[model samples]
Target: MTAGGARRGNTRFVVAGLFVAFVLAGFVSGYASSHPDGLEKVAEEKGFLGQADDHAFANWPLADYAVSGIGNERLAGGVAGVIGVSIAFVVGGLLVFGAVRLRSRGPGRASAPTGDRGPDDPGPGGPGGVGTDAAGAGAAPAA
Candidate 1:
Protein backbone atom coordinates (compact mmCIF):
# COMPACT_ATOMS: atom_id res chain seq x y z
CA MET A 1 0.00 0.00 0.00
CA THR A 2 2.13 2.81 -1.30
CA ALA A 3 1.00 6.46 -1.45
CA GLY A 4 0.11 6.19 -5.13
CA GLY A 5 -2.02 3.09 -4.69
CA ALA A 6 -4.01 4.65 -1.84
CA ARG A 7 -4.74 7.74 -3.91
CA ARG A 8 -5.79 5.59 -6.85
CA GLY A 9 -8.19 3.55 -4.70
CA ASN A 10 -8.22 -0.09 -3.65
CA THR A 11 -8.18 -2.69 -6.43
CA ARG A 12 -11.24 -4.46 -5.04
CA PHE A 13 -13.26 -1.25 -5.07
CA VAL A 14 -12.25 -0.52 -8.65
CA VAL A 15 -13.17 -4.03 -9.77
CA ALA A 16 -16.52 -3.81 -7.97
CA GLY A 17 -17.36 -0.53 -9.66
CA LEU A 18 -16.57 -2.01 -13.07
CA PHE A 19 -18.71 -5.02 -12.34
CA VAL A 20 -21.62 -2.75 -11.49
CA ALA A 21 -21.16 -0.95 -14.79
CA PHE A 22 -21.19 -4.26 -16.65
CA VAL A 23 -24.36 -5.39 -14.96
CA LEU A 24 -26.14 -2.14 -15.72
CA ALA A 25 -24.94 -2.14 -19.30
CA GLY A 26 -25.76 -5.81 -20.01
CA PHE A 27 -29.11 -5.99 -18.21
CA VAL A 28 -30.49 -2.70 -16.92
CA SER A 29 -29.86 -0.83 -20.15
CA GLY A 30 -32.82 -2.66 -21.72
CA TYR A 31 -35.04 -0.95 -19.17
CA ALA A 32 -33.58 2.53 -19.61
CA SER A 33 -35.99 5.45 -19.64
CA SER A 34 -37.90 5.53 -22.91
CA HIS A 35 -39.05 9.13 -22.85
CA PRO A 36 -36.92 11.60 -24.72
CA ASP A 37 -34.23 12.99 -22.44
CA GLY A 38 -34.34 16.62 -21.30
CA LEU A 39 -32.67 18.11 -24.38
CA GLU A 40 -34.73 16.15 -26.91
CA LYS A 41 -37.95 16.78 -24.99
CA VAL A 42 -37.25 20.48 -24.82
CA ALA A 43 -36.44 20.59 -28.52
CA GLU A 44 -39.68 18.82 -29.33
CA GLU A 45 -41.68 21.23 -27.14
CA LYS A 46 -39.98 24.15 -28.88
CA GLY A 47 -41.05 22.71 -32.26
CA PHE A 48 -37.52 22.06 -33.48
CA LEU A 49 -37.14 18.31 -32.84
CA GLY A 50 -37.33 17.53 -36.57
CA GLN A 51 -34.32 19.77 -37.19
CA ALA A 52 -32.16 17.21 -35.39
CA ASP A 53 -30.93 14.68 -37.86
CA ASP A 54 -29.11 11.40 -37.27
CA HIS A 55 -25.69 11.74 -35.67
CA ALA A 56 -22.80 12.57 -38.01
CA PHE A 57 -21.28 9.20 -37.09
CA ALA A 58 -24.55 7.35 -37.66
CA ASN A 59 -23.03 5.10 -40.28
CA TRP A 60 -20.67 3.63 -37.69
CA PRO A 61 -21.33 -0.05 -36.90
CA LEU A 62 -22.82 0.75 -33.48
CA ALA A 63 -24.37 3.91 -34.88
CA ASP A 64 -27.78 3.91 -33.21
CA TYR A 65 -28.54 2.61 -29.72
CA ALA A 66 -28.96 -0.82 -31.39
CA VAL A 67 -26.62 -2.66 -33.73
CA SER A 68 -27.16 -2.26 -37.47
CA GLY A 69 -28.87 -5.61 -38.13
CA ILE A 70 -30.31 -6.50 -34.75
CA GLY A 71 -34.12 -6.55 -35.05
CA ASN A 72 -34.73 -6.80 -31.27
CA GLU A 73 -34.14 -3.32 -30.00
CA ARG A 74 -33.75 -4.23 -26.31
CA LEU A 75 -31.16 -6.90 -26.89
CA ALA A 76 -29.21 -4.74 -29.28
CA GLY A 77 -29.11 -1.77 -26.93
CA GLY A 78 -28.08 -3.97 -23.99
CA VAL A 79 -25.35 -5.68 -25.97
CA ALA A 80 -24.08 -2.38 -27.29
CA GLY A 81 -23.99 -0.88 -23.80
CA VAL A 82 -22.14 -3.90 -22.39
CA ILE A 83 -19.53 -3.74 -25.14
CA GLY A 84 -19.15 -0.01 -24.65
CA VAL A 85 -18.68 -0.45 -20.89
CA SER A 86 -16.00 -3.11 -21.40
CA ILE A 87 -14.13 -0.99 -23.92
CA ALA A 88 -14.30 2.05 -21.65
CA PHE A 89 -13.05 0.06 -18.66
CA VAL A 90 -10.07 -1.31 -20.58
CA VAL A 91 -9.13 2.03 -22.12
CA GLY A 92 -9.50 3.87 -18.84
CA GLY A 93 -7.36 1.33 -17.01
CA LEU A 94 -4.64 1.49 -19.67
CA LEU A 95 -4.60 5.30 -19.50
CA VAL A 96 -4.29 5.33 -15.71
CA PHE A 97 -1.53 2.73 -15.78
CA GLY A 98 0.38 4.67 -18.43
CA ALA A 99 0.14 7.95 -16.50
CA VAL A 100 1.39 6.40 -13.25
CA ARG A 101 4.26 4.62 -15.04
CA LEU A 102 5.28 7.78 -16.89
CA ARG A 103 5.15 9.87 -13.74
CA SER A 104 7.47 7.49 -11.90
CA ARG A 105 9.93 7.34 -14.82
CA GLY A 106 9.98 11.08 -15.55
CA PRO A 107 13.25 13.05 -15.27
CA GLY A 108 12.42 14.52 -11.83
CA ARG A 109 13.12 11.06 -10.38
CA ALA A 110 16.64 9.88 -9.43
CA SER A 111 18.27 6.46 -9.89
CA ALA A 112 19.80 6.63 -6.38
CA PRO A 113 17.63 5.56 -3.41
CA THR A 114 18.02 9.00 -1.76
CA GLY A 115 15.67 10.26 -4.49
CA ASP A 116 15.03 13.64 -6.14
CA ARG A 117 17.77 15.90 -4.87
CA GLY A 118 16.42 18.44 -7.38
CA PRO A 119 18.31 20.02 -10.26
CA ASP A 120 20.42 22.38 -8.09
CA ASP A 121 21.67 19.65 -5.73
CA PRO A 122 25.23 18.58 -6.51
CA GLY A 123 25.17 15.18 -8.17
CA PRO A 124 27.71 12.64 -6.81
CA GLY A 125 31.36 13.79 -6.53
CA GLY A 126 29.58 15.92 -3.96
CA PRO A 127 29.41 19.78 -3.88
CA GLY A 128 31.03 20.20 -7.31
CA GLY A 129 27.65 20.99 -8.88
CA VAL A 130 26.95 19.80 -12.42
CA GLY A 131 29.70 19.82 -15.12
CA THR A 132 32.23 21.01 -12.54
CA ASP A 133 35.54 19.72 -11.12
CA ALA A 134 35.67 18.18 -7.59
CA ALA A 135 37.05 21.43 -6.15
CA GLY A 136 33.51 22.84 -6.57
CA ALA A 137 34.82 25.11 -9.35
CA GLY A 138 32.97 25.75 -12.64
CA ALA A 139 35.69 23.68 -14.38
CA ALA A 140 35.46 20.22 -15.93
CA PRO A 141 36.31 17.14 -13.87
CA ALA A 142 39.92 15.99 -13.95
CA ALA A 143 40.55 12.87 -16.04
Candidate 2:
Protein backbone atom coordinates (compact mmCIF):
# COMPACT_ATOMS: atom_id res chain seq x y z
CA MET A 1 0.00 0.00 0.00
CA THR A 2 1.03 3.61 -0.56
CA ALA A 3 2.06 5.82 2.35
CA GLY A 4 -1.13 7.85 2.04
CA GLY A 5 -3.25 4.70 2.13
CA ALA A 6 -1.37 3.47 5.19
CA ARG A 7 -1.91 6.78 6.92
CA ARG A 8 -5.61 6.75 6.18
CA GLY A 9 -5.88 3.19 7.46
CA ASN A 10 -4.06 4.17 10.64
CA THR A 11 -6.36 7.12 11.18
CA ARG A 12 -9.39 4.87 10.84
CA PHE A 13 -7.96 2.45 13.38
CA VAL A 14 -7.23 5.26 15.82
CA VAL A 15 -10.73 6.64 15.50
CA ALA A 16 -12.21 3.18 16.08
CA GLY A 17 -10.06 2.77 19.19
CA LEU A 18 -11.17 6.12 20.53
CA PHE A 19 -14.81 5.16 19.98
CA VAL A 20 -14.30 1.94 21.94
CA ALA A 21 -12.56 3.79 24.76
CA PHE A 22 -15.34 6.34 25.02
CA VAL A 23 -17.99 3.62 25.17
CA LEU A 24 -16.11 1.59 27.80
CA ALA A 25 -15.57 4.66 29.94
CA GLY A 26 -19.23 5.54 29.82
CA PHE A 27 -20.21 2.00 30.74
CA VAL A 28 -17.70 1.33 33.54
CA SER A 29 -18.31 4.71 35.15
CA GLY A 30 -21.84 6.05 34.90
CA TYR A 31 -22.37 9.11 32.64
CA ALA A 32 -25.26 10.97 34.31
CA SER A 33 -24.59 14.65 35.02
CA SER A 34 -25.24 15.65 38.64
CA HIS A 35 -26.68 19.05 37.64
CA PRO A 36 -28.93 20.10 34.79
CA ASP A 37 -26.91 21.12 31.75
CA GLY A 38 -27.21 24.33 29.76
CA LEU A 39 -30.25 23.23 27.74
CA GLU A 40 -32.09 21.86 30.75
CA LYS A 41 -31.33 24.94 32.82
CA VAL A 42 -32.53 27.22 30.03
CA ALA A 43 -35.70 25.19 29.64
CA GLU A 44 -36.46 25.42 33.35
CA GLU A 45 -35.80 29.16 33.41
CA LYS A 46 -37.93 29.84 30.31
CA GLY A 47 -41.01 28.17 31.83
CA PHE A 48 -41.42 26.17 28.60
CA LEU A 49 -40.57 22.89 30.25
CA GLY A 50 -44.04 21.62 29.43
CA GLN A 51 -43.26 21.98 25.77
CA ALA A 52 -41.23 18.80 25.84
CA ASP A 53 -42.88 15.89 24.06
CA ASP A 54 -43.00 12.52 25.74
CA HIS A 55 -40.82 10.05 23.86
CA ALA A 56 -42.74 6.94 22.80
CA PHE A 57 -39.70 4.97 23.96
CA ALA A 58 -39.35 6.90 27.20
CA ASN A 59 -40.39 3.77 29.11
CA TRP A 60 -38.84 1.44 26.56
CA PRO A 61 -37.34 -1.93 27.38
CA LEU A 62 -34.29 0.13 28.26
CA ALA A 63 -35.11 3.58 29.60
CA ASP A 64 -33.39 6.13 31.82
CA TYR A 65 -30.17 4.14 31.43
CA ALA A 66 -31.72 1.12 33.09
CA VAL A 67 -33.38 -1.89 31.60
CA SER A 68 -37.03 -1.66 32.58
CA GLY A 69 -38.36 -4.09 35.23
CA ILE A 70 -34.88 -5.47 35.85
CA GLY A 71 -34.39 -6.71 39.37
CA ASN A 72 -30.86 -5.25 39.70
CA GLU A 73 -30.53 -1.54 38.92
CA ARG A 74 -26.75 -1.58 38.56
CA LEU A 75 -26.79 -4.50 36.11
CA ALA A 76 -29.58 -2.95 34.12
CA GLY A 77 -27.77 0.39 33.98
CA GLY A 78 -24.55 -1.27 32.86
CA VAL A 79 -26.32 -3.20 30.12
CA ALA A 80 -28.08 -0.09 28.91
CA GLY A 81 -24.84 1.86 29.01
CA VAL A 82 -23.07 -0.76 26.89
CA ILE A 83 -25.93 -0.76 24.41
CA GLY A 84 -25.69 3.03 24.08
CA VAL A 85 -21.95 2.78 23.55
CA SER A 86 -22.36 0.18 20.83
CA ILE A 87 -24.89 2.36 19.03
CA ALA A 88 -22.52 5.33 19.13
CA PHE A 89 -19.66 3.25 17.75
CA VAL A 90 -21.80 1.89 14.92
CA VAL A 91 -23.00 5.37 13.97
CA GLY A 92 -19.50 6.79 14.03
CA GLY A 93 -18.16 3.94 11.94
CA LEU A 94 -20.86 4.42 9.35
CA LEU A 95 -20.13 8.14 9.10
CA VAL A 96 -16.43 7.53 8.68
CA PHE A 97 -17.10 4.89 6.03
CA GLY A 98 -19.29 7.29 4.07
CA ALA A 99 -16.73 10.08 4.28
CA VAL A 100 -13.96 7.80 3.05
CA ARG A 101 -16.02 6.65 0.10
CA LEU A 102 -17.05 10.18 -0.81
CA ARG A 103 -13.50 11.51 -0.62
CA SER A 104 -12.19 8.78 -2.92
CA ARG A 105 -13.52 10.69 -5.94
CA GLY A 106 -13.23 14.14 -7.58
CA PRO A 107 -10.28 16.49 -8.26
CA GLY A 108 -9.48 17.42 -4.68
CA ARG A 109 -9.25 13.77 -3.67
CA ALA A 110 -6.77 13.03 -0.91
CA SER A 111 -6.06 9.33 -1.58
CA ALA A 112 -4.70 9.81 -5.07
CA PRO A 113 -1.40 8.16 -5.93
CA THR A 114 1.61 10.49 -6.05
CA GLY A 115 4.19 9.94 -8.80
CA ASP A 116 7.71 9.17 -7.57
CA ARG A 117 9.86 11.87 -9.17
CA GLY A 118 13.23 13.04 -7.89
CA PRO A 119 13.55 16.69 -6.91
CA ASP A 120 15.31 17.43 -10.22
CA ASP A 121 13.18 15.14 -12.35
CA PRO A 122 10.43 16.78 -14.39
CA GLY A 123 7.01 15.35 -13.46
CA PRO A 124 5.04 12.82 -15.61
CA GLY A 125 5.51 13.06 -19.40
CA GLY A 126 8.51 15.35 -18.69
CA PRO A 127 8.21 19.11 -19.43
CA GLY A 128 5.34 18.81 -21.96
CA GLY A 129 4.36 15.26 -21.14
CA VAL A 130 0.75 14.55 -20.06
CA GLY A 131 -0.27 17.96 -18.76
CA THR A 132 -3.36 17.85 -16.56
CA ASP A 133 -5.83 18.86 -19.23
CA ALA A 134 -9.49 18.61 -18.24
CA ALA A 135 -9.99 15.22 -19.91
CA GLY A 136 -6.66 13.79 -18.67
CA ALA A 137 -7.28 15.00 -15.14
CA GLY A 138 -10.75 13.49 -14.91
CA ALA A 139 -9.96 10.12 -16.45
CA ALA A 140 -9.11 7.28 -14.04
CA PRO A 141 -5.98 6.00 -15.77
CA ALA A 142 -5.15 2.33 -15.45
CA ALA A 143 -3.16 1.25 -12.37
- Considering every candidate listed, which one attains the maximal TM-score? 1
> Candidate 2's error at 66, in angstroms?
2.0
| TM-score for all models, in order of appearance | 0.59, 0.52
Q: What Cα-based lDDT does every candidate model obtain?
A: 0.69, 0.63
User: Which 10-residue window in model 2 sums to the lowest lDDT?
Assistant: 121-130
Candidate 2, residues 1-143, lDDT tens digits: the string is 12335678787886687667656644654555558789878999998877989888897897777877768766778777777777876787787776555334345545438865746432343455335333344554531
RMSD to native for every prediction?
A: 10.9, 9.9
lDDT tens per residue, model 1, 31-112: 8888899999999999999998888888887876677678888888888888899888778778787655433422545455
- As a TM-score, model 1 comes out at 0.59
User: What is the Å distance of residue 54 in model 1 from its true position?
Assistant: 2.4
